[model samples]
Target: MMTALLLHGYASGIYSSRRIARAAVERADFMMIVAGDAPDFRTISEFRRRHLKALADLFVQVLKLAEKAGLVKLGHVALDGTKIKANASKHKAMSYD
Candidate 1:
């Protein structure tokens, strides 16, 4: 589940939770889950919402370890962007502020 979410967010070029779920189901190597069953959008959203902080922290730790191993330069950051396909209509999405 974690792998699926990360791949979807980082590599799958998908932002919609539904699409992420679909990608995981259709592309096993792209977002392979160890459990063999792909999760739905709601489950993926809940997992991300619940573990956002942990994920951030884990990413930081990976960067630090990479720096220590000379795999990445210290004080340097890389930014990656992917085109996201929006599935929601104006009627389905709203802003709080």
Candidate 2:
């Protein structure tokens, strides 16, 4: 059950244990997955920490299966800290009286 929670969270683009814990309560899909037995953030974090390598291996295997079934096309994804200026107007700032 815990493994399912973590895997489902990862597949859904949720990596933080805190966010996972929140989703278990707020998201119907997650609630259904856990059968209403939601673990706390600390428990989730500790479980993840203790089984990090195993979890990573399981994720890779699942990805391979997905690629085999044509469910996902694997590709390189990269992110950089290229900052972009916000387009907000100067007038949007609050002024003190």
Give the alpha carbon lDDT tens digit for every residue of 1-97 in model 1. 5644664466446777777777777776644553557777898788778988887787677778888999878775778898899979876797666
Of the candidates shown, which would achieve the greatest lDDT relative to the real structure? 2
**How high is each candidate's TM-score?**
0.54, 0.74
Model 2 is weakest, by summed lDDT over 10 consecutive residues, at: 88-97
Local lDDT at 34 for model 1: 33
The lDDT values for all models are: 0.71, 0.93
Q: Candidate 1, which segments miss by more than 4 Å at Cα?
A: 3-16, 74-97
Model 2, span 15-97: residue lDDT tens = 99999999999999999988998899999999989999998899899999999999999999998999999977767776565
* Candidate 1: residue 37 lDDT (0-100): 73
